[model samples]
Target chain A: MATSHTTEAVNLPSAVQERQRRAKFRRNMFYLALLAVGLVAPFVAYPVFLMKILCFALFACAFNLLLGYAGLLSFGHAAFLATGGYVTGYLLASYPGLTPELGILAGTAMATLLGALFGVLSIRRQGIYFAMVTLALAQLMFFVFVQSSFTGGEDGLHGVPRGSLFGVIDISSNLAMYYFVFAVFVFGFAVIQRTVHSPFGQVLKAIRENEPRAISLGYNVDAYKLLAFVLSAALAGLAGSTKTVVFQLASLTDAHWHMSGEVILMTLLGGVGTLLGPLMGAGLVVSLQHLLAQSPLGNWVSVILGIIFVVCVLSFRSGIIGELSKMYRKNFK
Target chain B: MTMIFGVPMAVFMGQLTLGLVNGAFYALLSLGLAVIFGLLKIVNFAHGAQYMLGAFAALLGFRYLGINYWLALILVPLVVGGFGMLMERFLLRRIAHLDHLYGLLLTFGLALIFEGTLINFFGVSGARYATPEILQGGLNLGFMFLPTYRAWVLVAALAMCLFTWFMIERTRLGAYLRAGTENSQLMQAFGVNVPLLITLTYGFGVGLAAFAGVLAAPLYPVSPTMGSSLLIVVFAVVVIGGMGSILGAILTGLGMGIIEGLTKVYYPEASNTVIFLVMILVLMLRPAGLFGKEA
Candidate 1:
């Protein structure tokens, strides 16, 4: 009366099963290769620069979780990032006894709260409204940061102490600090990976693909979205907090709308909906900015970035990784 | 000067005047946004940058080409609007099948390029845009004095908003536009050239933004950063007004501007944030917005 299907190995023919096994093997290999790069990158390059890349990579990954999977495009992500940076920066600067990890935790916690509030306000609206509302709220937060004395207004909270990770482990050394950042990046990435593979993550993806269909299937779509948003915000905050420790500075530029747009560019260029896409996008963009700043196109960075954005949206929506994967699938699948 | 609510009446009135002027810009900008959104279903994030270009075009024309304020007023909109049409044709047309968000992304990139290019050449300090000769001087009123240029900006902006509203709401061509907005494919089936209409609508909407920029050049500094901030506020205005009606956009923009001015008079610190606060409150109470119909 009914056909029975369970595991992929049993459900598919031997050839298909073999192909699936190869795909899984290939994916694991790619992850291992990426981890290898992560472990050795600090030694190969300037630790400070590598730390910057790691922080931004995490930030872009968090953003991709929302935009790529949750299908929610937020224009206020900078608020969470800035909020985290400022909170961590202030804690470390003013509270001499505050450990670095605690400062980061405080920042991530604050960003979580902000994300929750934002979710409550924004999740009611769909699509374009969500983006606009989020943007307006971010601008409001920007004004708050600009006017508030705690943010040091324009000067920002500078000269933050990169206190030791724990009471025992001193991380002021560039090498030590780079390792600490690497560990945190891996942790954040694992969390993202876990979330993306979970049942809740499947529901989020379902809602993204078809909200009405998801709702009809009895899922609390809003709650899933809100949770996803908060998680994204928390991770973004973690990135920001870590960056503050790495650079010993937190400023208005971090909270600026331009920062929000920059993250979007990274996600777009790296390839949305792909696990490694944002990481690649962040690395490419951060390096590009670093290179362009030294080149004759120094001040023209924004112009160049803008052109890239235009080209990406118009022609390369799949992005470098997305296109590569597409070609690979076309050839191999 | 007489006192009102423990503040000088002149100062209060001046703030109010400033508020109205801001509201005028808001109305003009959001009206264009509403118009464009009504059909395109895409919020033009480059609107602010385009507005800046309009102002810059006027300023550069005056400084370099000896074009007067009057001529720039006519010429800026055409030039900017024509530029908008080109963008629609070349850039937006390609991504017409994608998600609505891509339109926003494309425009945002355009904004960055525009603002960055301007900053590269002129720096951010901006330049003085002298008021037109005939529009110079102030008109004295019983309670306060009004600058001629500010008065002109208000009248001109209001006139433009009304004209646009009328054009879209009353005219036969407007009927077609409205029908298209209601259902484009159905209208296309009836032999309407929806693509051409879309191109023209984008141009017209962008023209309106440019027109407001021209009106604003004399009031505010003709600077690169000018339109960017104003664009955010206009975004709030659009959210509050809802893109449902052109009239809604105008009224919400003007109202928010007045409230902002009032806040300046009372709680000066909250002046910049009051409109955004209002937006949050509106979102909480009416998710569709005060004037926006739920799409």
Candidate 2:
């Protein structure tokens, strides 16, 4: 009976084709808007700051794809972020002529591979155990980085040059770097949005709501999750690589567990599953940091952030975009 | 000089002792984590921070209030535990109804606040907590020399663990606490005041962590970032032990600590990674953990 059902579903080409078309259209519209922001935003804000926000936004978006869609909360995403940053930083520092685009590709590819390796080990457990495992792996990485001489051992690789894009467009200019980062962020964000709304994404949501149902539906549940994990890791790598160039340095802070927490905060504060929420959240948090730095409240930033987190979890589970989505759904329905 | 496996036996014993000392801390910290997880169903990401708070509490008590080590040991845990109670009542209670992941995030946020506050006040470079005059020296054995304070820490931590184990496994109060953990509504139906029980359980867990901090201050430098670094290793210990079993948590922590020490003796580079390696191997062989029941 199961084999018959599986065969029947596999043979249904027209239905799948229709579903694919709708998914593609929705994804395309998202990319178009993201591209618009990437093109226009550099002129409006401090390009360096905008670049930072974009990098963090992409990082948060990647995180959301896993936790928001797959119901898998990874407590140690900094491991991947750090891994990508360090690899890219090392390559850029060692190889003088490495282009920004190629450096980012190398970093993203490395993160994707690491994500797959870590995913297989982590996905074995669910809920709390999954959080614990990822955190442990990330910590192990932290210690490795701490001892490795190439990472400059706590001082981190400093004064990293913003190599040109394809050896032509100099990313040294704040505006150029901002646009470059924005482009990567938009591309990464669009990929995440696409994956979450695709058939694969539906399978993930099914797993999140009810794993038994997803399995009974004859889906390869583990493979779907692994794919999501790798995709998330790749996007995170893109963010980290862009960040290395924008900041003109990659340091221990980028690889620290605190960075992982920061990314999670951005995702939660914005709206877990919403496309634009993470970008807004990244902006809000980075801006808040800037504002606080200019005031006595800088010391209390973490305290305030903590208070916000607790309140949001308790009273505002639906974040800014999440709340808007609810209102939109109500009116439309 | 006697040698074992191409290394001096003294060096081997020294690493073993250091590992055992670390194991003691791991056992205590993981024990608190297991208790919190068992009752609250939250991973208590703040456990390490709370432990750091305990050490800082001791340091502050001495620096400003003239509170000595002995008094601080008794007073710090109570203060930290009280803080934990307040957090549970005001902060954690609100999120108890949400997904367990929310609780984890909430605690994580609290950890950030705690660490940041400490850094702002004390700065990043660590403060030193001295060993009291009475416990300053070492005891000479035929084979090895043991620091008096180290011996005290090992003894005290063991006593605390055993006492906690005995209280929960052998007493009526423990029965109530365990029963509450099993079915809070049912226990509350019996007029057990389960809410208060949970509050006290969280306090007890936090207090245990504080107690470890007090013990650890003399051994390690007191710093704001201390908790964040140690939290991950403790999480690994909890995973290896399976949060389901109290004894498992304690045993795995101690065993892993010893393994870490042994690795340091042989291949110093892998010392930090040995626990994670063990976690992976355990997941492959027995996904639930050696003592953890299958979910």
Candidate 3:
């Protein structure tokens, strides 16, 4: 059933393929326009809020790299996020001489190691078991952080310095930090885009569609899955590290399972497989939270998100961008 | 005080009894999970929420309707079970043909909704549910004093788990349920109402969770977020036991709980994480779970 869908994509008619090529060009243009808007967005909207949206957008995109492309639903992604945040936060707080870039890199490294370990343990199971295993492992991490002195127990690591970028440009300024975040986000997004179009991604897709067939075709499916999981984890870590710098705090909330669910909500809401879907989803969710924070309805955010989840699973599984593209294809064709 | 492995006997016995009580809960919750998964082919993530609802239902019954403990015990499950049936009819049935993961996600969302709504009303601090007048006191068990309420919980949960095992494993209806699990289309060919059976099965599974919840209310403060954290542990327990065998789920749950309790006595720091550590070891050694048939 999965193979047929991928095969259909591969075996498209030349005329239709040409149309798809044109659509891709149009989509690229749309992305460029969106980036332009984002660059100028801080002038009108709160830069801090915009930064929050970008951090989450990158996180969700990293998550989508697994769930959308590789068909792996990891329910423990918050572990990587938290690991990155805590490592970065601890380094910047204790070692005042450490550069922000190094701290971020260090955080990402920790997340990569964690990802590699968790991915190796969890990749043995398929489907629901995989999700449960990741969750259990993440919960273990959560407890470790809670009980440890470094994480400050329930209060988390606070007052993490933004520090200088490469020992020259001071990133303590909000604008500098915002632009720094923007650069990191762009880099992360580019990496995801490049990874998706690479030869390795095709193999990952093959594994996702039909592991048995991929194995028959001489592909080591587990290796591919592990690699994808690690990549997803590292990028998610990058997002977490960037978020710590942006907010200047690394709290327990970042590593909580609810954060993992929030990222899933963003990815699922935006469009699971589409490149721009997670960005849109992150923006919408962040905005929803922002708006709701001022109203009595703030407490209802989970319920609302829950309703959205049910609605999405029931009838809108294709998501916003997925549905839009479908309509565009129908109308254009 | 006598010592066992250099630990005081009272501490050892206390932890052991506590472990057994916790084991009872794990067995009960995981059993319900296994049953639902056995027939429905969907992991009911909302099982924890249903358990929470069972506790809340009892609390509400007392606060508003003045219903006592014994009556609440009987009524709560029926109410929660009816809600589960409605969920199956409206939400679950629609996605019955999709991938099993969708069911997991759907129920996950449902759980969030239930938990969140409850939080909005009750707040996060949790409400108290007093132990019944009959089960208020403690028993001097010689080695260690045992709270009568906790002992009742252990016994009641064990009885419920055993009864459920017997009903599913030995009865004629259980045979049909098992047959349907193996091949629903074949069972339907024999004039069984597979759809109704599926709904009732889900309801029954949810009802069992609620039954556990009612038992837990007086032991712990009734709260909305209570189920979520406990749910993760139970998920680990379910994974360790494997979802395929009913007896496996029961044994694994009880065993893991004892292990956790023992950890508290021996290595207090590792108590929270021993189950997950065990899960990692189990995954490495037996990827399919201790009792599970290979997929």
Give DockQ per model, in order.
0.90, 0.68, 0.84
lDDT of residue A46 for candidate 1: 96
**Clashing residue pairs found in predicted model 1:** none
Instruction: Give lDDT per model, in order.
Output: 0.92, 0.86, 0.92
Ranking according to DockQ, highest score first: 1, 3, 2
lDDT of 2 by residue, A244-299 (tens): 87776777887778778888888888998777788878889999988998998878
**Worst ten-residue run, lDDT, model 3 chain B?**
B141-150
User: Candidate 2: how many backbone clashes?
Assistant: 0
Best by DockQ: 1
Ranking of models by lDDT: 1, 3, 2
Select the stronger candidate by DockQ from 2 and 3: 3
DockQ of 3: 0.84
For model 3, residues A1-333, the per-residue Cα lDDT tens digits are: 457667988899989989889989987998899789878888888999999999999999999999999999999999999999999999999999999999999999999999999999999888888999999999999999999998888998888988899999998878888889998999999999998887788888888888899999998899999999999999999999999988999999988888888899899999998989999999999999999888999999999889988998999888999999899879977
TM-score of chain A of each: 0.95, 0.89, 0.93
Specify the highest-TM-score model's number.
Answer: 1
Superior by DockQ: candidate 1 or candidate 3: 1
lDDT of 1 by residue, A1-333 (tens): 012324533767888888878889988898899889888987899999899989999999999999989999999899999999999999999999999999999999999999999988999899988999999999999999999988999999889999777878999999999999999999999999989977778888999999999999988898999999999999999999999999999999999999999999999999998888998999999999999999998999999999999999999998888999999989976
Better of 1 and 2 by DockQ: 1
lDDT score at residue A267, model 1, on the 0-100 scale: 95
Model 1 off-target regions past 4 Å?
Answer: A1-19
